[model samples]
Target: MSRNILRHWFSVLVATLAALAISSNAFANTKNYTVTAPDGVALSVQESGNPLGQPVVLIHGLLGSRLNWDAQVGSAELQRYRIITYDLRGHGLSGKPTEAEAYRDGRRWADDLAAVIEASHASRPVLVGWSLGGAVISNYLAAYGDSQIAAAVYVDGVIELKGDQIVAHSEVYRDMISSDLKTHLDGERTFLSLCFHTQPDRPTIERLLANAAMASWDMQSAVQSMTVAASEGLSKIRVPVLLLYGEHDALVNTSGAIARAKQLDPQIQIKLYANSGHAPFMEESERFNRDLAAFIETAVIH
Candidate 1:
């Protein structure tokens, strides 16, 4: 085997053994804190992996907390880099505002990300955003530009929230914000279910359901109208960009998202996971981590 391939396998083996030795639910040497956004929203943030290594900020999707990045944060191959994960304004342990203005304005989301980056003292961190997280990155780039970061990776990311790019699931979205608790919970379950081609274990699903349950109803309702700065943001990024999408995605038109991203910047890299769906980072995490590590190596150098 090639030296790189041997190293990859060695890392996987070490990670596997390390996982067996530690509790499955815990991240070792994790540091947790709260970063206040520009609008006074407190974002719950966590840092794991190698603290002294290059930083990587991980932004989760709608209805997801920082826990959504457990796979990436816990990987052995990824341990060489500092990993940062945070809860969005209306998600997880973060502050949740009921007002429509807080969720409708995309700049607020971007500012929240900036606040986390600034507070963490992360120098030129690589941004890895998933699903709705992609829109957050776009808005951030539009508002602040790419001078602060090294590179970006969008995993099954949503390029735009409207038009043919988004898969139609209007009823599920409507039910998500329903006043009736059962309807709302069921909607959340269905929405999470759509994220995978092969569903996770019952325990994992239950945990994710709990995470979704913690999300704000007002935010979910208002986020539908949030602006995505694809034209302004994607076009302006001078740093390397990679789009990793699943071939079987149920929630997004992967081809359309890729097309839009390429139209904005032809230099952006693209990778498709043929057997996976909306959550390819979770569905095919080993390969995803390997690919991410390879990209970061080149990104940091550039």
Candidate 2:
């Protein structure tokens, strides 16, 4: 039965469309500031690209920051729109809250996203989430609904934390929360490695490892059990949604997530990258950017 569903799904999956030639003639504006969430966690936010164009918010996954969007932010295709990226509470330049509740409650993460959108004055921006950031989008939709956003894209998103949907790397997760620094860092390195089927360049790997090291220990320990709110969030979205997944993903059960997402919202579009892994945006960037740009264009139009 599952095989049949997958076979049918593959037949109908949306492939990347012809690239959109969006000109970057306008002078792109870059801005940086801090937005304080209702709970007082200061989020580091950055904006680039046409200041007057439609907004696109790029949310990174666990242990990742705004730097994760370097490929998209720097792409000429995306430069035609206003691009926004921000670090989550426990990552990058954002405030790292020590309390367990800060990481466990899904609402706090949702509130943080809402705060960033409101603070940035992004009117009906399209939300794009990667990995754990996908869960953040789910939580945001649950708490705030789909009224504020124009569309949503989930790149290798974690649909739920269920055992079937998530690939088990027990030792890596356990060591990540270990009290010893070496053990924790080693675990983080291993976890980051699992994010790709085609490894990135040496410098990219090293920089991402450093990003992992800077994450809040408390947040890492608590986020494993964070509330996902998939039922309340995903099922309720009325706007367009695109689920982009890599077939070779090592950290997530790609087929399972796709199946679950379809069950929730059969209308949601699906796209699969056969050669890439968890981070398709980084692995097959050119194609990913084209698909994304195409989606953004269609979303903005209708």
Candidate 3:
């Protein structure tokens, strides 16, 4: 073969190989699936990383979806572990039943989580909950028990669901559940703004807004109305617990909640992000990802 022809062929092969590598890496990191809850609601579930590695399930807060954990999902720190994130009922791409009964009492939340766990084919997977997701994890413990959970991570969330405590700790919650549309929208805007210590980039802000808008107000109200205190079952969780919160969080009283959770389980680990607010994972992603990987490595049971 001519030297010029040989060089051209080699370059073409190199480019083809690079493209194949890129495609393979993308495919290896993301998988989407649908799982049915006990009540017949279907959830949109996404899994990434090594499928056979230690499983970690991430549950997003109220009016949030799996996208809330996008930073963690795509992080290289979590690439060694199997990561599962799903939209809660009435949130994201998950099935939304308009009936009030569907979201009543938080049992459906537990069932939905159970279904996700079952679908992941993971035994005793670590549970990571942010904001209202903490309530879902607590409810899961109350309904299904913690036998299936290897560990738990509560991120700027409500660990103790006492009505008085909730009211006192978060006026944001009050605003979010308000009856007036203007009040609700205003509250949501404020709530999103409070989620970060500094203003997030425009793309991140837009994504957050889009997810918040997708949530059904009626379903949210129903869930809020039926809030059951999960404090009673905190003592029953046998696995390690990690509490993550932002120091500058304007949404919830992070200090009070951490103090309360410590009283319940003195052994629980706590990490406060110095400059972050409600969404530490989004605001301080590098530190959050590192800490999370460490926690899963040292704490979570296989």
Candidate 4:
């Protein structure tokens, strides 16, 4: 979808449209920080907005880094909220244990995120996830309960996957990663390019490649465990849930995830970006930041 089309769909944590979407004359200030999750994963996080603003924890999906939220963290509207975006254990500068067990479970990733929130010293921050990040958030809620989470949002996320497709998808990724791991670096860049149709921001994509190699080689185990966690635990999440899907996302279908999440928690909110797909924040920065800020403004974040 065209960038103009995406603007009407999803939003970002940043206060203004990204430099790619709008003139550099208007933009939000961005900063970077790193924190350790409870499970010992040292996650790299990018933060923006007011120091005294309401806290919002952002999570990126599979093979994605916290840098994916660069636009969100740099938007003027997003300055209203304390935005937190980070790479999962195996995706960014985060510490990745070499053992298979450490890389195999979403619970560990959840612990890492929980630690980030507590480390920030925020009382209760709203949690937001995109794509596989949704699954991690779901698992975090299921594993830790919602005492620290005031609300949550999903941008083109999948709450559940049919058993067969899950297997098929896993197989494809397994083969892809395995074949690419020989050079390791080459594979990560290839994977990133596959994730986005547009050539990504140069420095950001290069940083992603650098971090991917920092991840443990036991990625297959991580993917499998996370898949199972999302499939089995979707019905148990209790916090206020929001599902935002891009209209044309092939990664996570709107109807399927909505129906599944509804079956699990009827209170879940589902919104569709009329002209967006998997990466709505990048595709539609302005409208997304506006709508997202408005939606978050409605939340009584303590």
TM-score to native of every candidate shown: 0.93, 0.91, 0.85, 0.78
**Which of the two candidates, 1 or 3, achieves a greater TM-score against the reference?**
1
Off by over 4 Å in 3: 1-28, 163-184
Ranking by lDDT: 1, 2, 3, 4
Among these predictions, the greatest TM-score belongs to: 1
Count residue pairs with overlapping backbones in model 3. 0
* Backbone clash count for every predicted candidate, in the order shown: 0, 0, 0, 15
Per-residue alpha-carbon lDDT of candidate 2 for residues 1-302, written as tens digits (9 for 90 to 100): 69999887766653212122232232244588999999999999999878888999999999999988888877777787899999999999999999999999989999999999999999999999999999999999999999999999999999999988999999999999999989999999999999998999999999899899889999999999999999999898999999999999999999899999999999999999999999999999989989999998898786
Choose 1 or 4, whichever is better by TM-score. Answer: 1
* Model 2 TM-score (2 dp): 0.91
In model 2, the number of clashes is 0
| Displacement of the residue 60 alpha carbon in candidate 3, Å | 0.5
Every candidate's lDDT? 0.92, 0.91, 0.82, 0.67
Best by lDDT: 1
What value does the lDDT take at residue 94 in candidate 3? 90
Worst 10 residues of 4 by lDDT: 19-28
- Specify the poorest-scoring 10-residue window by lDDT in model 3: 161-170
